[model samples]
Target: MRKLLLPSLIIVAASLLVIRIFYLQVIDDSFKLKSDNNAIKIKYDYPERGYIYDRNGKLLVANQASYDIMVIPRELKNTDTLEFCQLLNITKEDFIKKIEKAKIYSPRLPSVFLPQLNKSEFAAFQEKIRKFEGFYFQKRSLRDYEVDSGANIFGFITQVNEKLVAKNPYYNSGDLIGRQGVEESYEDILRGIKGVKYIQKDKYNREIGSFKEGRYDTIAVQGEDINLTIDAELQKYGEELMINKRGGIVAIEPKTGEILALVTAPSYDPSILVGRQRSKNYTKLYHDSIAKPLYDRGLLAEYPPGSPFKILTGLVALQEGVVNEQTTFMCNHGFAYAPGRFQRCHCGGGPRDLHVGIYKSCNAYFSNVYLRTIGKYKSSPYAVDVWSNHIKSFGLGQFMGYDLPTGKKGKAPTSKTYKKMYPDWGWSGKTIISNAIGQGEVLMTPIQLANMMAAVANEGYYYTPHIIKKIEGKKIDTKFTTKHVTTIDKKYFKPMISGLFDVYNLGTAAGLRVEGIDICGKTGTAENFAKIDGKRVQLKDHSIFVAFAPKDNPKIAIAILVENGGFGATIAGPIASLMIEKYLRKKITRTDLETRILNTSLQAQYAKLGGLSEDIKLELRKNDSILKSKTVIPKIKIDSTKEN
Candidate 1:
């Protein structure tokens, strides 16, 4: 019986093994796929990157022919290393490093040896292409900017590193990936589908023919061209107006919520980051700590919205039913909350109504209103949470989820925010009363401020501000089409609109009004601060302005913020008015204003951040050394000398 059991077990095991082998050989093709991979050499057909056009169909970004030297690590023979290095303008050390990197990526796969070669370089290298057995040219398209502006908007593309390749199976050793801005946001769409050609290789690794008669081969699909919502003329005009200044301007269409112009000052031409010079230019831009040209202040800089924030305050006050349109607050030059703790204001001391408050940017009226809103609830935390919710409903404290790949969630203080800060002290709305005037812990980006103005323009509703107007054979994201309604009721926005209109008629921006354009705008001068010598020193104010035009059927809503610019009306207001006029009328009526802004340069004011001047800074260093020498005690003291 034991002998019979042993034979039976052996037979059953053999039968199971045979069944498994049959399944692997016939039913499953995974092993066959792996075998084919070893015998097949893949040739990637990289498609052209998508064309980018402005809303008016003007070409903004096009592609130019670029060549990359690709290498298969195991395919190299007794090649002339010196000739290869000299031809490619690379060192022997660089060749070794690149070769090792490619091997680490995949010995059997192709990797970039030298990328982004011009036509001349490619022609020079093509002559000796047959000399190098492992090396070959992989033609690809490089971004050729049609316009010189909007580098921050278009962003740049670069070769995928080992880290990116390991994470995404779609990319290999030498693929391009978008870095920042719109390019990154729509990378999958813009990159298109890469096709592959598989050639059969013999035991000697010589190409024979197509694997399975090109059954697995696919044709390359060119990237889909896209239209941005940005108006090319408006974008250029806005960039021109912001020359030599550090600021951001965001203009949105009030009717559709399309981004008309996104301008960040101290920006570089997008072409600088295109070819071989891209890496060098990018490094230079990255190292520029001051007047950071690479930094997109339009979406990243979180400045105190200044008086532009008062718009949200008023809206929240109305929504909370803390104040009515006719609500009046007394302003004795400012709101004096606790004894001698006064928030100073420049709005002429008088009994000011809501209409009077907004145009004049009265600190007193809004502070009182803010305090009243907080007073409505029993607990300060409860009150603040309510206020924060109303503020966030306008998308102040969070990311607006714009199509751009980069941004900052400018802070709107909540109860939890204050609870952590004022843990021991009793607090109320007046405790953080600076918020009422767009001060305090309140901060907002240029885009957010523009969106807020758009809400006001649409009378309590705004579409999500987006950059895409149309994508080829595809619909823009539904979020861009969807309307975002504010917490404030529609009826409450009328009086606020009247106040904003009065701003152009009888307010701070009276000197910068456009003819035939009934503008509704607010000027803001948020106090700037810097740390000098371990002390928080107050710098010049950040000039801010937000506006919408036509007053009845609003077309454009815009926001501008200039760092170290003194008063809002002086720099930001004039720029905003000119932008509105440019977008709406397509011609500048105010030539003098345009000339003045073009001529004006704030480089001197920006330099003052380090010291009064180079001479003054030198003098201070000199004095600092002198003071240190005077305070120093003698190393060899008299007492020690006497004892010796």
Candidate 2:
């Protein structure tokens, strides 16, 4: 019986072993996957990025073919390093360093060895690529800009860093990622999914065939093309007008809240950020701190809104019931806050109402109105909070949630902020009366100012300002489609709009009116100061203007800021008027104004504050010559022989 039991146990164990062996050889795929990893070479097929077009379907950005040399460190075999380096136009040291970097990234995974090779370089390397083991060339696309404007808005793409690769599994080593602007904002939509293929290799690492007859492989899906609200011609015109200047201009379609043109002065050609020379050009542009061409001043620069802000003061005064359209006060050139301290005004001393206050830009009238508004509330702190709330309702003191990747939340001082500024003494409206004139603690970005004007044009509400009008396959977020209503009542905007209209007809911006367009605009001159060597020194005033054209049913709203350009009416007003005229009329009737602006260069103003470095000066001088030559309007002859 014992002998029979032992034989039975042996029989059971033998049966179990047979089943396990069958499973290991045929059913289990874990070991098979591991084996495949060793012999299968994976390659990626990168799809071309989507094209970017303007509102009118004019191509703004397109793609051009580029090639990258890729490497898998573990598969590398001993070869002639010097000959390989010479063939690829790289030094031996660079070869060694790149190899080391690839190994550090992953021994088995692929990494870029050399990137962005032109057609000639790719052709030269292709002939000898078969001799190099574990090295291959991958085809890709880089941005080919059709227009030379909007470098700040049409950001460039660059290779992803190790940090980014580690953070996002979707990206691997040597992958290109968008850096800024529309590219960064819509990276996922613009960057199509990368397709992959696994090639079966023999023991000697020779390519045998596609793994599983390419069943696991996928075809690259092309990215979706996008259309922006930008007007390419308008953008180019604005850029041309802004040459040799340092500031920003933002134009918006009032009804739709679509950004028409966003211009930052001192911008470089977007093409400079493409190809093998991208790094070199980027380094030069980055190091030129004096002229930050890469900086998007329209969205990022926080400056006091200056007198354009006076429009808000008038609106807030009316909303709080502290002042009316008929309310009037006297200004003796400025508002005398304290016995010795007076906030100066340029509007000649006279009796001024809300309408007169806005056009004349009377500091005294607004100051009195602001004081009354604050005093209406029981406590100054509570009043400040109320005032802050009213101002912020216009999208001040917070991010406006524009489609751009970057922005500044211009300040609208609340009680909390004032508390931080003055902890000991309790504050009052008089203490912060400078805000009445848009100078003290108020600040706004160019886009914010433009959006505020858009709200006024819309009569009380504004759609969120956005650069993207339509996505190829998807609807824009509801936030952009929904209207953002201000805290002020809709009824209050009437007087405000009237006063702003008066600004063009009878006020500060009266002289710069377009012939037919009834443009409503406010001129501002912000006091510019900087702390140099631990001392506050006043620089030239920054010229500012905010406007909307055709007064009623406005088509365009714009804001222009010219740093260190004295008097808003002198520089910014004309620029805004011209921009409006160009957008509406499609041709400049006032060529004299156009000539004045095109011929005017603020390089001297920039030079005064050490704003121009030697390198920037040289570039500006070269650009100046090119601009001068192009702007020389040629005469049109009457062809009498072929006349109608």
Candidate-wise lDDT, in order: 0.82, 0.83
**lDDT tens per residue, model 1, 1-644:** 98899999999999999999999987764456444266888888989889999999999999999999999888888889999999988899999999999898778788898899999999999999899999999988899899987777898889888898889988977789888977899999899889988788898888999877887789889889999999999998888888767789999998898999998877777887877878877776675545567778899888777787788888888888889988898889866787778788898889988999999988888888888888889555778888888888787889898899889999989888888998998787767887777777888899999999998999988888899999999999899888888888999889999999888889999899888989999998866566555555566667889999989899999999877677899899999999999998999999889998887777556655534435444433332221101111001100100000
- Model 2 Cα lDDT, one tens digit per residue, 276-353: 889988887775555667778899888888788878888888888887788889888876777797777778789998
What's every prediction's RMSD, in angstroms?
9.0, 8.4
How does model 2 score by TM-score? Answer: 0.90
Q: Please estimate how well model 2 matches the true structure, expressed as its whole-model Cα lDDT.
A: 0.83
| After superposition, candidate 2 runs with Cα above 4 Å error | 1-36, 533-535, 610-644
- Model 2 clash count equals 0
